[model samples]
Target: MKRLLCLAVAAASIPVSAEDRTLEHVLVSVPIHRQESNSVLPVTVITSEELQRSVATTIGETLENRAGLANSSFGPGVGRPVIRGQQGPRAITLQNNTSSADVSSFSPDHAVTVEPLLAKSIEVLRGPSTLLYGGGAIGGIVNVIDNRIPRERIEGIEGAAEYRYDYAPDLNSGVGVLEAGFGNLAFHLSGTSRSTSDLRIPGRAIDEAALAEQEEMMGHDEEHEGEDHEGEEHGEEEINNSKGKIANTDTDTDVITAGFSFHFDEKGSYAGFAVNNLNNKYGIPPGAHEHGHEEEHGEHEGEEHEGEDHEEEEHEGEEHEGEDHEGEEEEEEIVRIDMDQTRYDAMVHLYEPMDSIEVVRGFLTYTDYEHKELEGSEVGTRFKRDTWETRLEVVHNALLGTEGVVGLQAKSDTFEAVGEEGFIPKTDSTELGLFLIEDFHRNEWTYEAGLRGEYVERDPSTNAASNEDFTNWSASLSALWQFDDNWQTGVSLARSARAPSTEELFSNVDAMDPEELVTHAATGIIEVGDPDLDNETSLNADLALQWHSANSWAELSVFYNQFNDYIFLRNSGEEVDETAVYDYLQEDAKFYGVEFESSFHLTDLGPGALALDLRGDAIRGDFKDNGDVPRLPPVRVGARLSWTGDAFGTWVSVLNAGDQDRPGDFETDTDGYTRLDLGADYRFSFAQERELLVFIKWKNITDEEIRLSTSFLRNYAPEAGQSVAAGIRFSF
Candidate 1:
């Protein structure tokens, strides 16, 4: 790791020309209600500029680097953001305050349908927001804000177009965006396409040792070559040195979106609609060689064994042939395992104020989503979901102002899995919640407090007996103190909970191969309809300090969280026939973390100014006897130093992650490593009304082989190494 840091420093010293400086920062702004009177939750906001500068391909990837957040990748095409180590249905994803209807909650193989390129801003809300959103948000919420509809009537026509390209490891990608506005109406449209072949490690070939171990598990011998036929001759070189393309390793994705909105004359009144479509295809890596042998033996054993007397002889021959056939089949299957996914979403939102009361406001949202996946010869699975939400709130202006809000929400989902034995089911749920908040501000001291109550009822389509109902509540309090003009401190405490989703309670399907096993349950250990499967509750606390001086700023925060009856996946200790069963269980757990960030101007030697920024996140967690959770991101630290001026800007950074020792009952230990990246941009002002910007970036500077602990492909191969990309943007 020290050597890796040294390499990164050396790479950062690369020369940059004076004419190459440019502003590459992304600028974002969104309308938000004042938090003074209604909400005490600590919400973090990330601008588009911050996301654009990071070497991230997806929205989840961009958020994973944030403090107290973890991201797990199923492969190159799928990633889910984990808040304080909680993921899946526990964390909610919202596009413009509406739920994203993608099948990402059901499986890791599916990709999120929302596009990051079109987002104006992304907000992560922490604390007790579950009352308004539902049981799925015990952890937190990720909100993607986009402006596809006009909030007011436009007097003239206006439009903007943007294009970007990136190159990394063995992958290359491009994106295009277009937006226009006319007469009280605005429309947004965008298209993005990307493709990547097999990735390559920086300084190493495919981890042959790891591959050999995987082959052994599959029951294959290392001495065998590619030959499977009896009496077939094999070359010594082929048997001794195995080198070839890795299996199930490719990715391709495309997306398109179109949306429009209009506004009325009344203040705080607007309505808009949007439509999004996405398509993605990726490969699923193959299992070990031994599994292949058993399958081959089973397939040809009946045909090869003709008579009873020869059955014994045929069995012996079958063993040898099966092993060879398995080896060959493993290679073939890895390259052939392909899956495709398609999704569509439509959403509408309206916000207005009552005429009788200037402090009273109302908001409503409705969304419809459909998604489907295709794997091999199977028709895959399909899901359709609909959601509607309404909220009414009144603001206060007096001392220690009082605010109250009441909300109602409903969600319905239908699922279908087509195959030999068709499986079809559906779930519908409705929730009602009420909240009140009070804020007091005097001199340098501020205090906030809020509470919420929610009632929920879930109904199942296929199994009427599975219907369930419950009520839950959450509350929070926070205080901030201003020590001086440049210094401030804050502390917050909250209690929250998460209710089980339909997929966790009543969906049973075969979703894995030999090496990987997945089992859904019709009823969890907590029991459905037991009236006792209430929300899983948690307590959270945070302390933070911020300091700002002329040309510099810094922040540090520490947080702790404890959960009672935490919903987690664990080994059931019992196998059905020959397959392992992992049941969703509730247990106690704890998590703690500290984060620090700072940015400062280093020098003024250029056209503008040179700056340096440092940031890092460290997290640790304990699970009560259930073992550590699978795919927990390891502690990571990174820093970037850049020189920014009028026409040119350059930056270099290094990232390091500690090895992960926490493995679930079915997981393996993952090694840690470091990576380096550098980027620069240049701008040219041709005409007063026209400007051109060019960006060039180099990732994995030293091409170090680093594998993320939270990656599913870590066992087979690490992430891509060094690569370069250059693109040009024009505005007029």
Candidate 2:
């Protein structure tokens, strides 16, 4: 701890003027379009340059360094962001202000479809501003903005291409984009391809401590198996455990997008459409337990020979053939997911549409998405979702010294799952929402208020499940005060409600019969849902202070949320068919957290301008009636030092995660870990106008073992070890 503080202090003495200024002026697009500093909410915007430098295969990995964010990784291919100790359905992911339309929220092993490399800018919004998207966004929102719609007209043709390689995973990735404009019409095309081998780790793939605990328990159980010789001792079994590399962690992905837009009315009103297709094949690391078929086959065989058939089955050739076939199938299968999505989007924006409206915007999107979970050569389960969504907003002119936006959003989707792990039946879901927001400005204060109402309905195809509907509403109010020349403070309060999701209400497991129970292969648990689940609601409060000067900027925020009928999945202390049982239940819960981020610019101590960036975040969550919330992220703190010149830049950063001693029920503790990384880049002009840039990065130089508390696969697969990544880009 002392060494970490010393490094932070030394790094804090440097300065970077250019980057600080750029961050101050960046605009955030969610809720409303406004400058980051001018808004009453907590917002973080990653510009194109910053995004290019830190882009990763998953959105969670790309933004994990930011304050208040953690990556809950399933493997190298799947990472979902956990915000302020909230994840899954609580934190919403968007693409250009629209839903990404993926089933990532349904399970931790599923991957988000958004590609960070293709984004022009990424915006993160927290606090009351999240109400504009959905009341369910109690945690936060992530929106990836791309140029596929072409909001502005370009005069000429421009394009860029880049390639990157990483040594640890033998990853090779490339991206290309091209844009052309002819008068009022513009065309855009882009593509990206990424492929990686199995992830490499520093030591054994499995956590030995966790494995030992399991074996010890098993040994105790085995000791009482034989009453005739209860005093006899047994030897431990010798198992072959893989080392250095995590098997079945490879991934391959490809994306293609084409768009065209036509600008008219003096470039004020433009309509455009874009088409995108994505295909990905990724592996699940061993121990994820994709054995839905194996369990069923074993149970059926056991039931068939329960009585006098035991002796007959032992002598039957057909029974032996059946056993051999099942063995072959098990040996030939490796669990993986093959996913694809085709999306179409259209948008139109109008300025000064009427006397009372300053701007009007409309968006329409249709998506066809499907993913098949493969158990070796055969598909274990196939999940499909077809969705269409539309939204319209009118920015009304100032009235009574207030300005705001009124919006309407509607979405519909049909979701289906087939084959062995299909716990939830086919369901059709529909949602409609109406929202209003108003902003009032004063000499030293800015006040904003918003209200939203929504209707959600789910209808299942099977008669065993009935239709469910909900009416939900939310409200928020916030005020920002500029108390001093370099200091500002904000206070916000909100009440948000979220309706139950399809899976939360419709997971079908026959509790009466163990053999008939449904098990989710990805999680290795029998999950049962309640049909009478109520809406989950929360009351949130936030306070923030920000200070800025010529050479420094800092922000501190604290938030608390109290929930009524919080929805959570919990183990029921029951086992059926040799699998644990989990049920979706509601209980009162509370979460609170603090986050601090600061950057200091100092005089050039060497050949280039220097700056220091420091960030830290901590969160705690627990149920009011009982124990701590499960899988909460540990406290984290980090620091970075960077030096930049006209053509060259270099940076070093260190992040440390505190020990997670408060692991929830049935969870194991995770030790603390510190990671260090360094990178350098150079850019120069060539061919009179074109530019070429080269960069190199060394990640996890210390090669520490990192087991994320928020990850379901933490005990089986640690993060990648020491690796070197290099890339080059050429633009014209």
What tens-digit string does per-residue lDDT give for candidate 1 at 442-502?
A: 6787776767777767666653346777678887787888879888888988887666555
Q: Lowest-scoring 10 consecutive residues by lDDT in candidate 2?
A: 296-305
TM-scores, one per candidate: 0.78, 0.90
What lDDT score goes with residue 94 in model 1?
79
Give candidate 2's total backbone clashes: 6
Off by over 4 Å in 2: 1-20, 23-28, 31-33, 128-130, 214-240, 290-333, 509-512, 605-607, 687-689
Per-residue lDDT for 1-732 in model 2, tens only? Answer: 232232221111112234655456455364354577778778866777776677888988887767777788888999888777777778878888788999887878889999999998888786534457775576788888898888788779988999999988889999999999999998999999999988888886667566444334334235434443212311211112346787778999999999988988783788999999999999887655531111110011111111111111122222121121144423443578999999999989887867888778888999999999887777878989999989888888788999988999899999887887688888999999999989898999989899999999999887776789999999999899999998999999999988888777887632456676777765556767788899988899999998988778888888989989987776564656656566678888888877777877866766677887888777777887667776677777778888888789999888888888776544567888888899999998887469888999999998888888777777778899999999998888
Residue 711 CA displacement from its true place in model 1, Å: 2.7
